[model samples]
Target: MRTALNLRLFLAAVIATAVALVATAVVLNFLFRLYFEDRLRDELETYLIQLSGNVAVTDSGEVEVGPLADPRFNNPLSGYYWQIEVAGADPVLSPSFWGAPMALERPEQPGVIRVQDINIGTEEPLAVAHWVILTGQDAAQRSLHLAVALDRTDLDVSVAGFRLNSTLWLAVLGAFLLIASAVQIRLGLRPLEKVRSEVNRVSRSPAGRLSDDYPTEVLPLVEEVNQLLDTNAATLERVRAGAGNLAHGLKTPLTILHGVERKLRKAGQDLLADELQTEIASIEHIVERELARHRDSGQSRQVCEVAPVVRRLSDALSQQPGSEQIRWSVEVDERLRAPFDEFDLTELVGNLLDNAMKWTDGRIVVRGALSGTVASLTVCDDGPGLSDAGHEIVLGRGRKADPERSGTGLGLSIADEMAQAHGCALTLDRSDMGGLSVMLAWEQAEAAPR
Candidate 1:
């Protein structure tokens, strides 16, 4: 449903060019027909002048026509003919006429020549020039009608050939115009393409900004976009500062409550102390989850190698108390890179590995690979995995599959939130290692030197 600007412009240019060429062809055809017909009429008039000069009247009153030089006039039905008529005498005809006179309307006045189209029993019409002349003096004076004609089919054939040639050339011109229009549209829109690339660069890096080296027409848009990026960057800094202040303000009270819970336990008030502990833990989980979300929200997306982060997390976790007895299998390509903030990737992978270290049965597998533009990171363990329904429940805050586990159930929830923030999908499935498999996949960014 979305139309491209280049396509729209090209289509408009095509329609306009087609219309102009068609109109030109029509006008040219009409003008050429008139021109060719005018030339034919002039030729006929020339013949009529020659015939007038050669005409004579004898004393006995018989009309005589001297021989003319044109050979076409001597051939019968040759589409050329001449005729001379004297009052009260038989008409003088050319050999081409075959004794058939053209039905021509004579000029009303002597010495006046008129030209018109007339049919003379031929397939095509004839262009005839007729002249009425007075010969002799006094009582011997007589009116002479002189006429000459040529077949209209000759003129029609010439015009038709002109039309064909003109149309072919016009079509060639139209094609050239269309190609030129397409190139113009592409060159004209190149600035917008540059703007899009610059915008993408800004999104992928915290400090990237649009440059001013652009055309005059596109400069204003570039300036506005750079200003907007500056504004958003300022706003994000303020939001991060606010989140930090909120965390500090809330943490102090939670710390004091922890001390108070210890006092109540020393006084043997076990029930009240337990209740306070539960509330304190709940508040702590909420604070941590919210703080993580805030951090992820302000993080700029960039490409980072997946193997280094995975291996670093694995090494750090391996030194932990329980993980010392477990085997960590890391199989990630060094070149596999995805659009993710380093801190976000660390937090997400760290949580998944920590969770696996908790329930994993002495063996864990971490794998990262790139498939086309998508990069996938999978962390699997030999620990007992969750059922299909429990998969969804564990992703909720504070909801652990086994309530008896000695930790707050915020790990998977925070990892899931971070994955979603980075436009990645976190899925839980049964691992081949007989435990939970947490896979995070996202579209990879353009390749960059590490």
Candidate 2:
């Protein structure tokens, strides 16, 4: 199946949300890590400043460690350490170092601060160092380097936790947004769905029209469709009116010609009179064909129940002279519908039944049933069925199996035109009754090929 528009839009929204959330999580985590690194540097710099002020050179020319402010500096292997180095004396280390010598990079100049990573054999820490020139008792300047270190394990743990929490919350937010997008898409397009349903209804019923109660976005479209329908209806009406007027105007002249033919026959000029009658009959056939074409155009899109229409046509046909003698059997379900206008259905069936009545000796049957997307109909008669070549001839305009019949031979041709108009296939073949069988199969109007 083709994907629905709303579903495609919703999927795009979901994918976009997921990508945005992932990007947001990555950015937030990165920014937080930078902030944490700055905080670590500031803490290390503060410790380094305090250590510089506390350093001293004794009168014995030996370096001595003073009482430190931070308790972690006094603990063994506490992961926070301070070390002091002098240019001409041994380096002094804090108790927290546990005698593990940290390789620290010296600062570039005096009173200048530097931050670097120091890795002992077992652990890595961030170190901040500063170099200072101190004046001893002899007024000699001694270069002192003070450095403070802190382990990065705690910062890493904090960042990992923040990242995990951010991902989970962002995933939840994305799901909520997907649900909201689905609802919004459906609500936004509900007006178009309404218009579709109403348009379908109008196609099935000629009297139906789309209402103006639509969203502003769809109002213009609905108005244009309604106006087009009105224009088509008016145009069809005018054409049919002209056809009807033409038929009426020709009928009087044909009647006068028939009178002239009758007079010639009474006056014993049968050969010329018969030739004139044949020509007049051909003219009448053309008029009937034109009228049938106009009648079919305005009735193609209507929907009607098959059984009622068949019964109504059968009842009307039975009132005619030869129709009463035939055994009429109709087998149609009441619910079996045909996608054809009621009048069109009557005309299509009437032509077939009228021809059957003309040729049948006793029995005629009309059967209708729907299967899948097709409506199947069969009209059978107990008459001398035509050969393959005759079938083609009878379906042609003004061709009859028997010239003795009163018709102008336009019945099947008109029926063929009606079938084509409604996207139906009509066929003639030998029947079970040892006679002619006419079959019509049409798809549902929506599925019909235009």
Candidate 3:
């Protein structure tokens, strides 16, 4: 649910650090308390031994204990309290003990010293322990226990005070850390923000470009986009210029020719009428050819399924003159597709098969193959195919092998040019159908936008 990228990462790190700090504090407090208790118990044991050494039995069966010369060691008000219990019929002890019973955990358990909570006096909460020892008086062995305690009320108050200040500091530090992290997030994303702004700027019109001012990571997309724009621009310019030149070249000549014809008619000369008609026919052919070229060039290459084109072209060829007389057949993998413009596809196949129908009387065959990023289209006919000279001339620009040949005759040349433009090639070979074979191969581009 947390949408900020840097904040999420920073918070995760901070939480982890806080958890580690709490764990460390707990471990250190445990160790520190343990060391402190051990030192306290050691002092208590030393005091018990000193008090026991002061005990005297003067061989009169009279027992006497401390009223020592060590003034510093005699104070019970030093937050150090003790209870020496000497086992006897009625052993008397210090009246300094006022309230709160010292709890000896696991009764009769004796050792160096240990810490425990005890009731020492009214409103008094003391951490206490006892040290037990044996005394030898002739044949009598007497047990004595020295109980020492400290008032923990003051220490608890100091610890609680320290905790209060630490909590406030932790809150201030956490706020400062969050603020710094937010600033860092903004700084880190600044470059991406600039890229977004530039993108917005470029989106206004077709003249836009991905700018060169970008991080290295974004350069490839910029370069590919620029290449596409440049290529499209060049193509558009070429098309515009070609259209203008074609209009001027064709329309002006036709207009002048019309004027000359008008003058001839006005002069009453029927002499060169047939020649004039032939010139008009020639002009019409040029006009139709260029028009077809313009239409075909505008047909962009696209990823088109090849089987359908083959079927369509084959069926059309079957309806052509002398086509049904020749058996027709098509073989193409149904899944195969090609990078082809619709007009080029028609022009390419139509030319090859039309030329084939010229002589093929038995059968015509069409095959479409897809292989390793390349599409190969084969069109073959069984008629008496092209002569070596005729075959070469058939595909040449505006050149018909026999001067007697008819038709606009730009089919093969146009197919070649279209193939080149689409990053494909054309090949000629002998068909197994016993005629000339023509193959068109091209690399198809993907339809998806990068």
Instruction: Score every model by TM-score.
Output: 0.84, 0.85, 0.43
Off by over 4 Å in 1: 69-71, 87-90, 211-213, 259-302, 315-328, 357-365, 371-374, 381-390, 401-407, 429-436, 443-450
Model 1 local distance difference test score: 0.85
20 in model 2: Cα distance from truth in Å?
A: 2.2
Candidate number achieving the greatest lDDT relative to the actual structure? 1
Candidate 2 lDDT over residue span 278-299, tens digit each: 8887898888888878877756
**Candidate topping TM-score:** 2
lDDT of 1 by residue, 71-93 (tens): 89989889888888776666778
lDDT of 3 by residue, 1-450 (tens): 557766676777578657755665566556655666667666656766666677654444345677634454345455656565655524334444444445454337554555577655476767776666666665766666666566677656655565565556666766777667667767766666776665554532335676787668766766776787678657856875786678678887777776776578678875675457457646655654565466445344444566777788778877877556787778887766565544456666777777777757678888876666666888887755667777677676656554444554566766766667556788777788677888988764332222
Where is model 2 poorest over a 10-residue stretch in terms of lDDT? Answer: 441-450
- Give the TM-score (vs. native) of candidate 3: 0.43
Clashes of each: 0, 0, 7
**Using TM-score as the measure, what is the rank order of every candidate, best first?**
2, 1, 3
Q: After superposing candidate 2, which stretches have Cα over 4 Å from the reference?
A: 1-4, 98-100, 123-138, 252-300, 321-323, 371-373, 444-450
